[model samples]
Target: MLRIKRLDIFIVKSFLLLFIGTFFICLFIFMMQFLWRYVDELVGKGLEMSVMAQFFFYSALTLVPVSLPLAVLLASLITFGNFGERYELLAMKAAGISLLKIMRPLIILVCFICVVSFYFQNVIGPIAQGKLGTLLISMKQKSPELDIPEGVFYSEIPDYNLKVGKKDRKTGMLYDVLIYNFKDGAENAHIIYADSGKMEMTADKQHLYLHLYSGELFENLKSQNVKSQNVPYRRESFREKHTIIEFDSDFNMADASIMSNQATTKSMGTLKASIDSMTHYGDSIGRQYFKEAMGGAYSQPSGLSKNDTLRIAEANIASYNVDSLFEAATLMQKQKIISSAVSRTGSLQGDYSFKTYTLETNDYQIRRHRIEWHKKITISLSCLLFFFIGAPLGGIIRKGGLGMPVIVSVLVFIIYYVIDNSGYKMARDGKWIIWMGVWLSSSILAPLGFFLTYKSNNDSVVLNADAYISWFKRIVGIRSVRHLARKEVIIHDPDYSRISDELNALTARCRAYVNTHPLRKIPNYFKLWMSVGEDNEMKAINEQLESLVEEMSNSKSVTMLTALNNYPIIAVTAHVRPFHIYWLNLLAGVIVPVGLFFYFRIWAFRIRLSKDMERIIKNNAEIQDIIKTNNNL
Candidate 1:
């Protein structure tokens, strides 16, 4: 049996606290984004508070799966980041605990979250989506609240346009009102001008009642007896006129069944079933279309047997050229034949176009169902993937609080969102396979998560700038020169006689090596790669050079110390083969491009080696001269 330690408990508690807080933050952000997309539909409609609350509730449920992965990423980052910032992670590691052990508990929690994410995506998500869709459709159909502003024609009403020059807000009365009623038709519209009016909705909220005082009405008359050029109209003046306009302000919830067939409103099982049914349906439609085309468009004509039609078609093709026949025909006959062929071609085209549209619609539905099925699994897996990435990254970065972690988390989430959305569109439009598109983001990020985990566990300086800079410099053959400062305290003075003898030996060795190697010429390709041993002679020379410099650093003479610093730090084996293994070198040489790269690299190193040998010989001579001068003093 495994026991839970205090360390695990502490980590679990810390992650949970952050997870809960960050979950709400992420959900709110996603909800706001979702709401913004449909703001036009929801705004200006006189929806009740309870209806709005239901809309929000269903929207939140639908967005839970998307929000969970981001929450996991952010929470893991902050938890591990705090542990690293407080040096708690270091302390645990120092106490003989591995990074994996510290993370085991949170890993379990994240796994549980992943399962919950799947449940929400597969079960609760579809139902909420259906309800939300229904609500949005209902909201879109509902009429806007009645508010007629001054100096603008209000056409929100069904068949009327009313303009008010001014209005009394307290008394709810309009002034200088002009109304155009197009109930019958635009040509026979009734125009009314009122000096003052009061508008109110009926108790049923189904009609608007407009009462105008001192108004004149002009009504166009349409009569069968009247001539078209001389139309009659009716004009009436009244002290007060009341007109009833039809307008429904009441909100009616749409039927949930309207959105029941949508792909997003289906569970995983339903999606699979729907996909199977749609596939069969699409296949049947395609076969039917092919059969129809064969029978109708390319079939034998009426009263003609198959053999007879085939013989006739063959004879026509062999005996006559259609262009020559057309040229021989009369002009009217040619025109008639052309018109008949064009009509037949248009009919076939239209028939096939309709068939193609039907098949495409079925295929589109099948793709959507397939995409949704893969999405349920991909989003759940993303929760786990994100935690692995965030936990390892936080430990690597070693920064806590909202600032750095938030920025990193947002940047990472943006990349995931972009890739995921692009893949979704491609898959939705049948440009990519559904599984590949839905899982694109996860596949791309999985290796990154694994790499970060490996680096964090091994305590690698993966984020260190200086390490990358040094590697880059080495790759580009940019050498670094030594800068040695003179030491204030010397325990022992240098022996000029002993140093003089060593310097002469070193100078002779450098001269002999440079002459034997012939650094100015290119090395033998086969021997350079197929040979495996390092440049042991150069290695020994470098070692001996460093030893001499160490002993000479205690010299009292400034010129002697300066000469010691001038000896270059050589890359001992770089001028030889690329690697120590013969097989790797063989592989590199067998591949022409890689061989050429390493060949040029070796040549460059050879040139640098020649320069280094020259510097060493000169420095040795300077030191020898300095020692003689000190001896003379």
Candidate 2:
């Protein structure tokens, strides 16, 4: 028990180390992006440095959910890889520690992480985003320093264009400033050519002043009366404020986006307001429908029978009147009132149907948001899945190197990420049920991880080289034998009257042919060809014999008899029924007999040539002996 505890402690520690490292690494990368995005905006607006810092801080907080799952997966992979490398898992297994036992502490750690992630998602994340939005909004109104270079037109405004020949940066003095103003159809609208100008902020910085010196403004009026008169000219000084010019409304609180859900949860009052809004809209629709049913209530009124019973019944629904005419008119007016109410009620009912449909749509959205609301927790739980994947994969591979495991882990993670992200999109788009889309990836990989883990735990050799190796061994252990006819051979007594003389003669002939003629150019002394097995070689040799037979037939000079002399080969090959296991009773036919004949013929020719040389040597020696004998005589 103590030893098991120690192992669990070690595994947990490793997981924590890897998890924390990946978390910080991913956090740092996201933080850098957050800084880059807002830093320039802050500087451009001349906002206080503190605002930029706050922006980055809050932005980083919002990005946590996206980074957490990726970090968890990376961490689990590294942790398990380390264990597999050090052989600690092997050691634990040898000691009879079950896989489930090893996973106990890890699962507990995942649960703890999941809880923390949930808290972060629900609490810290929304608040941080809200604060970030507020900070950016506050900075948008601030005026930035304008460094207008000489001899270039600066179009910072949407419709107006300005060019300054030169400017003193320190004094904010402008020289040779030219401003072009556009009009809704004023031909030659207006141009202000100033000798010099200077800019200054209002005491409260609510406005900017461009004071000009001795500059003439030209305006071309299209009116004939004005055109015939003197052209309009004036010395101009323009003043505008940041408020008059609209800046982007982008960086606002986005409170509606962030707080609606939070508000929905806080009190019944908030939900009641949304419900009431929907209810009110429903009532409006019902009213329209009711009015449509009433003849000409919502439409133009048409003259109809005033004495009709339904109209009369509805008409007399008023206080007493003077006479018949007045009484009828009053009654009709009263009927209209009742008709209006009925019309409103009918419209309200239709509006209610639409509202119900919309509410179902919203409900689907809310269910989908269960994942978004708990995104961090859900993503963090993926750590358990990854742990299963990494741990088992490491065991199966039994390799500790970063190269292979990292590649494998990345591939697995890519698949997981693709599925998860795809499901999320489908859910968001209402294409799939929220539960299926949000948890689909997890559902898939979790079981797969478990199966792989179970397999690894059982020490099942999922991939082994033995099966292939055994096949090769079987192939190597084969040999081939030619089918020899069962004609009995007996050595006949050296007399001609021997009964078995014919058999002996045939045996001698076959033996002489085998010995004298070698079909192959060179024999494989090692007989490694036999290692290829008898069946395969036999097949090959038979193919060669068949091909030789065809060649012999094509070339009439190359008879089977001549082939037997050149290439000595023999096979007791018999034909078998197609696709059948049974063999046919067939005699040992002469296959590639011509090749065997050539083989023996060459061997005999070479042997004879050697014997002839020996004879010459013997003759020379005999001649020498005879000469010696004669000389002695």
Candidate 3:
């Protein structure tokens, strides 16, 4: 017990060291990826160092749960792998400590980590996500510094475009400036041309003011009364002009409260509350839509019957025949009736379209919130799941360090990431159910984790290289002859010539039977497949030959032994009988195409069986001749 305690301590200590290092390393990698994504928005904006520090802090916090699973995966893999590689695991197992017992301590640690991850996701994650979102918005709103280039029109300013031909930067002078203004409206556009201009932002950094040495202002008035292509316009010439453009160039942080309404920025409790509220709202709207669709009530005219329904009431339709109604009414009356009916249908269609869109939008929002709610738990639970996967996988592979472990870990994480991300997007887009999409990765990997753990505990060589190589060989048409060990038996004085004669007669009979009784009729195959039957005569002959060969192997005759080697072993592998696997028949019957496939497949097998019988006859004839030659001597 003392030794086991020491070993447990050593394992935990080793795992902790690897876990800490792997955590930060994985965190750094994720952080670098995050940086790459937002570097464009973050770089060269003159952001304060403190703000950048805060951004990095929140970003790291957000990535903790993200990196936790992979870190635990890598760390667990390394820990167990190092143990296995150094034969420490073998020693522990040999000393009566099972793999599960060895895993007990680390499993507890991982469970604790899972709880902490859940807490982080529910508490810290939302806050960091909220803050990060707010900061990013603030950054996006922060205008680029007041540096306008020459030649191209710079329109970063609100509703205005400006161009400068040249600038004397040393003296802060400009030449040949053109400006376009559409602040009021695009149709009421205003253009300004100047020989020289200078632009500067206000001291408050809220606006840009342009001063021109010589400029002309032109404006167009939009009017519907003007029939000509050319509308009325105004022009003014000035030796010097000034224009002011609204531009907020300061970095003002947005209110975090502004982002509090988003699902990503909400805690699990908040998300649940919102989901319930929205669900109730959606249900109410759906009920209302159904009520409206069923035409619960309508303000019909006083003369209309109460029995009249929404979609062509019996009395109303019966009273209307196009030819008779047209004959009864004047042309003007008919036109009026048709127009009223068309207008009414058009109104109802527009109303239904609006209601449908409203319901769809509400349902989509509900799905997104529910998706996020499930994501909170699933992502947290993934830490434990990945531990199960990585730990057993490492024990199975029995490799350590940065070589195979890295590749396997990365590939597994990539598959998990792809599944999780795809599920998230699909759920958010309403393509999949909330729970299904949110739990997709966990659901997929949980069984895999169990399977690997089982294999590891059972000491199964699931990743054996030789097994895969054998399968590969079979795929490419390479077949090996089955070899059997020779049984030690006391040779008996037997009639070798009689044995050979019997073998030759059996082979000729089997060959003749196979050729004549080959499955020539399609109905026979169907009957055999349906009844799960085989040719009993051939089966009896095969059994007789096997027994005869067994008896003759004890003969003190070399020719007999050589002949036995040529004869093939046989079993009833012909048809899947009715009393066989219920599910197989059910599947084959349910999927008719596959059943037909098997039908033809069995037909082809019968042909191959006939050929096998022929080969047996030829080999038996050779054996008979060999024994006969020995007898003649």
TM-score of each: 0.80, 0.55, 0.67
- Predicted candidate 2 versus true structure: per-residue lDDT over 110-226, tens digit per residue: 767776665565677767766766666566544455555689886655445679998888878788888776643445556778788776655555544567776777776555474
Ranking by TM-score: 1, 3, 2
Give the higher-lDDT candidate: 1 or 3.
1
The local distance difference test score of each candidate is 0.90, 0.57, 0.80
- Candidate 2 lands at a TM-score of 0.55
Better of 1 and 3 by TM-score: 1
lDDT of 1 by residue, 154-229 (tens): 9988888999999999999999999999999999999999999999999999999989999899998887775568
After superposition, candidate 2 runs with Cα above 4 Å error? 31-43, 133-151, 157-160, 167-173, 181-190, 200-203, 211-215, 219-231, 235-377, 397-410, 460-633
Stretches off by above 4 angstroms in model 1 are 1-4, 85-87, 90-96, 223-226, 298-306, 309-318, 321-340, 476-633
Q: What is the lDDT of candidate 1?
A: 0.90
Q: Highest TM-score: which candidate?
A: 1
Top candidate, metric lDDT: 1
Give the Å shift of residue 490 in candidate 2: 50
Off by over 4 Å in 3: 32-47, 167-176, 182-197, 211-243, 255-257, 289-323, 326-328, 421-433, 470-633
Global lDDT for candidate 3? 0.80
Candidate order by decreasing lDDT: 1, 3, 2
Output the TM-score of candidate 3. Answer: 0.67
The predicted structure with the larger TM-score, 1 or 2, is 1
lDDT over C-alpha atoms for residue 51 of model 2 = 61
